[model samples]
Target: MKVLMVSWEYPPVVVGGLGRHVHHLATELVEAGHEVVVLSRRPTGTDASTHPTITHISEGVLVVAVAEDPAHFVFGEDMLAWTLAMGHAMVRAGVALGKPGLGDGWQPDVVHAHDWLVAHPAIALAEYFDVPLVSTLHATEAGRHSGWISGTINRQVHSVEWWLANESDSIITCSVSMEDEVTELYGPQLPPITVIRNGIDVTTWNYRQRAPRSGPPRLLFVGRLEYEKGVQDIIAALPRIRRSHPGTTLAVAGEGTQFEWLQQEARTNRVLRSVTFLGNLDHTELLSWLHAADAIVLPSRYEPFGIIALEAAAAGTPLVTSTAGGLGEAVVDGVTGMSFLPGDVEGLTSAVREVLDDPAAAQRRAEAARERLTADFDWHRVAVDTAQVYLSAKRRVRHPLARPDIPQRPLPGR
Candidate 1:
């Protein structure tokens, strides 16, 4: 099926798990024999130009990136300001395609949007082309940060999230936990929501198992080290964990607004020297650290779905995460990995200690994790599942009289 996919993040341009998730999802969709076009706003390069909504660009699948420059409008605290430009660019691409041979009067079977970032365009294009609109929300800010953060201007962000959930023909979320969040926040206005767990690419992470880093057992935190990620909790656990593990090292491998505070937290905990602030790393560095770690920790206070945990599992590294949102969903509680209560530094310390004190246990968990990830979280499976969501959305759009017609699909440039 011809699918128009929209997201704020993509590979190479990706900032966090969302980008990686979208890229893998699209890649797997291609593998599943579907045509996919991705519309994302990115830093402008020289080759930027007007184009058709791009067709089968991947092997047996088509992916296109409609780029836009958002750096100028994004200065302070506008980390995701690119989403606005991305929405505008996607709308422009759709309108341009409708003009002549570009669209060829042939509409895509459906328009699929990744998050609220592309909601405006998804709603617009679906209406313009008279097709179905499907949106997959990764998380709500309420669930992600555990509070109401959409104040004032960025309240527009939350409004858009609500708009998309209301506007789409159907909606999908990464976990059951997130489905509840949407229902709670958007009420009856939200579209029919389904639980589709996020997935990872196992091939890149699969390698000849190597011995983990010795002396200092490496613990990794690989996402944006923001407050919502509970990075400070990792630092707090370090003080006690270090007393027991001695040479245990925590590598903070992402860049965000939380860097300096984390650096300060390290000093406050007196585990500064024990922790290595690896700053921002490229994919190679992240993969190398993933391979080297005795355990990868994502002590998030809130996470919609923990793709990082799956990546760690795919890399044959034992995962330790808080029993929050999808972090708990990915872990099988001592089978694949272990979990601690949210914000429980003591519990966090204990979980980390289990893996650190018993290297053999950690190794066993990593192997089991690899097996579980390969069996359940493969990108190929994810692609097919997401394709099913697309099909489901289309079917629902076709039978609007059976279900109350959701007003989201045909709004113009909304």
Candidate 2:
């Protein structure tokens, strides 16, 4: 299958899990014998001479980076405009490919979009080419703010999400909870939705077995330092954790808008010195930390799918995550990893303590999580399943009267 994937984030321009997910997904699809083309923003400041760099990644995959000028627009002044410009650039790239003898004269069989950032171009190209449109929504704006669409920017984002959900021929979400969110928000306008859990390359994380640790037991948080991520909850729980395990330390990886606030929170709670704010680490450094840490913590208050938790499991590190959004479904509470209520400081403190207090049990659980990862969450399996979704979407588009093989939730008030 020839697939055109439109995403705002991709390698070298990655900001979060979305970029990593798309890169890996596209690569795995290539491995599965499918032709994949990824359309993403070109790295900023690329020499204008190389406006569109089409990178040939392996025989089956290609990445096209379309450049845009940042000087023309303000960052915070107009993010919606920035998003639309990126989308327009992707459309332009697709149109350029429609010309014959351009890079083997290939065209996409289906248009797949990740999130609302590329919705405009994905929808337009799918319609222009008369191909199926499949959109995978990572999370909803309403869910991120806990069901509130505050600020004009957020409202605009939510509106875009609604438009994308309605326009696509088929939809995919990372978790069942996210599927419910899309159904609730988009109502009858939503097309068939598929729930495909996020996966990890287990071998990449299992590079080295964790060695015995001495001194302070390291607790790691690997995500954006945002309010929705619940990094503050972990900072709040540190005081309680220190009362029992005084040698414990928390490592905050990944940079975000709330970095300064997290520093303030740690200082205010008197655990500033115990917390190591490692701004952002590359893939190698991140895996090293994952392998060395005693436990991995994801205290997200609104995660659609906890890819970090799966990474920790793949790394054979014990996980403790909150029962927020898809996280509740991702981790098997008490069996695979510990779970705490979202925003419950006390609950988080206890969950972390449980993992720390029982080393053997924690290791057992981590091993079990790894087993699950191998059995169910391999990227190879994810690619095949995703291919099935693409075929279903394509079939439905070709036959309007046909029903989807994957049962879709009925639209509200049906």
* lDDT score, candidate 1, position 10: 72
Candidate 1's C-alpha runs over 4 A off are: 44-56, 67-72, 75-83, 208-213, 394-414
- Against the reference, the lDDT scores of all candidates come to 0.74, 0.83
lDDT of 1: 0.74
Error of 1 at 190 (Å): 2.6
User: What are the per-residue Cα lDDT tens digits for candidate 2 across 270-326?
Assistant: 999999999889878988889888888899989999898988888888989999988
Instruction: Return the number of clashes found in candidate 2.
Output: 0
Q: TM-scores, in order shown?
A: 0.87, 0.92
Model 1, span 179-221: residue lDDT tens: 8878887777556787888887777766436474557677888
